[model samples]
Target: MLAPFLIMLREGLEAALIVGIIASYLRQTGRQAWLPAIWVGVFLAIALSLFAGAGLQMASAQFPQKAQELFEAVIALVAVAVLVGMVFWMRRAARSIRAELHASVDAALHGGAATWGLIGMVFLAVAREGLESVFFLLAIFQQSQDGAAPIGAALGVLVAIGAGWGIYAGALRLDLKRFFRWTGIFILFVAAGLFASAIKALHEAGLWNALLDPVYDLSGVLPESSPLGTVLGGLLGYRDAPSLGEFLGWAGFLAVTLPLFLRPSAPMTQAVGQK
Candidate 1:
């Protein structure tokens, strides 16, 4: 439950931030006429995401046990790929996102593109984020054994929406750089866990075998059935006696990914006297 909550919260907040930035830019530049198109895009993206999640869920339900495991493995892998891509994409785009949006808007309006184009731009932007969230949520839901996960996810998203609104309305001030920095680090750990979970899924599917036996059994000391253990397992990919494959997958993923993500990008240098 906590895992789903945190993942959705982070992802939802990102989508909210993007929407807020675009909306605020339009208002500041007297392009408020296009605001309706933005909302239309957002709604459409959400609908598409819901449809995708439902479709995947229905399809998975028809599979046999091994097939279901395979499907889960595939989904988890997809989610990890999307999450990694998002982290890098946002990092690279952080400095130029505002300028890019402004340029795209100007081009659309000047090119005599219909409002549909404006709507499409917003739709695609938000939909990318929405679809990614859908995939992550689906992956998490597949692993969840309890009923609390869905409720927690819903609450997280609701909170994120409120936060987004507050930021956009000037009622809240978010340190976005700091927020992403901490969340990005935390997400690396989450991704590592997901990777390990994916390996477990593949093994269940009979696709891979643990080359090494369980490293050690800690379930007696830290039972996953316990609330604290469950939280740790969900959030940090904790396992009592993890197989060699799980350990290697988790460690390798974090070791390779975290360093690159942590490296600072070149500073944005604005022209002097420009606001």
Candidate 2:
């Protein structure tokens, strides 16, 4: 529940910020008439995302058990890759995103087909985030069996919508740099877990035969079914009895990725919607 919630919250918040920034830009520039196009793009992108997610889920249901496990592993790997790319991109782009969007808006408005240009701009922006969310949710849902995950994801989206509105309205002042930085770290952890799970899934699918030994067996003391274990498992891919391959995959991912993520970079001079 918590894992899905946080992931969705971050993804939704990103989309909201993007739409809000564009909307704010339009309103401020006396282009309020073009605002409806943004909504159109947003709704369309959302519909596509929903459709894609449903289609994938249905398709996976018909697969045989081993095939399904392999599918799950593939999805997890894709999610991890997407997530890692997103985190790093945002880290580098955060300071310049506001300027980039404004430039995009200008370019679209100046184009011969202004309406379609704006629509396409907004659609691509929102769809990128929406698709990212879809993959993350699919990976999370495949691992979780209870009813709480969906509810958590829904709540996260709602909260993100509200937050976006507040920020656009200037009713809230959030340190977006800090927010994204911490969440980026959190996402790295989640991606590491996903990578580990993907390894386990591959083994289950009879694809990988190496590292069959148990790295640690604490199933009796802290079983995955236990409340704490479940939470840990969902958040950090905690396995009470993780095989050697799983442990190495998880640790190796963080070992290589975390340092690069935390390394020093150029300073950010502006927020997402600065004038």
Candidate 3:
């Protein structure tokens, strides 16, 4: 539940931030006529996400047990890839995103493209984020059994929307740089868990089973189904009794990914999204 919530919060906030930036730019440039098109793009992106999520969920249901496990493993891997890519892309783009968006909008409107071009630009921006959210949500949803997970995710999105609006209205201030950095770090850890979980799924599907032995057993002391266990499991990818392969995969992923993510980059000379 917590995992899905944070995932949606971060991803949804990113989409909201992009939408807000575009909308504000349009208003400032006296291009308010294109605002309706922006909304249209947002709606389409959301519709696409919903349809894709539903289609994938329904299609996966028909598979046999081993096939289902394999499918799950594949989905988790894809989600991780998308998540990691978005984090890096955003990190690199944060400083120039606004100017790049403004330039894109100008080109779209002036290149004999008009409203459709602007609409397409907005669509791509929001849709990319929307689809990423969809992938992560689907992967996490499959691993969850309780209803709270969905509720948490929905709430997270709602809050993200509110936060975006507040930022746009100048009623709130957020340190998005630090926010994104910390969240990126946290999410990489979560992705590490997913990496390990993917390996477990592959084993279940009879694809890989080298380190089948359990590293440790803690179920008697702290079952994965317990209240604390559930929260930890949702947030940190906790497993009461994990296999050796799972541990190594989890550790190896973090070992390689976290440092690269945390390494300092050249500081932005200009604040792109400042109020």
lDDT of 1 by residue, 20-130 (tens): 887898899898988998899899999999999899999999999999999999998998998888887877887778788878877766766758877888899889988
Report the number of backbone clashes for model 1. Answer: 0
Which of the predicted structures, 1 or 3, would earn the higher lDDT when compared with the native? 3
Assess each prediction's global lDDT (C-alpha) against the native: 0.85, 0.91, 0.86
Model 1: per-residue Cα lDDT at residue 107: 75
Cα RMSD to the true fold for all candidates: 2.5, 3.6, 3.6
Model 1 vs. true fold: TM = 0.94
Report how far off residue 16 is in candidate 1 (Å): 1.4
| Model 2 lDDT tens row, 115-138 | 999999999999999999888889
Runs in model 3 lying further than 4 Å from the true structure: 267-275
Q: Tell me which of candidates 2 and 3 scores higher on TM-score.
A: 2
Clashing residue pairs in candidate 2 (N, C-alpha, C atoms within 3 angstroms):
none
Instruction: Show where candidate 1 strays beyond 4 Å.
Output: 268-275
Q: Candidate 1: lDDT of 94?
A: 72
Per-residue lDDT value at 205 in model 3? 96
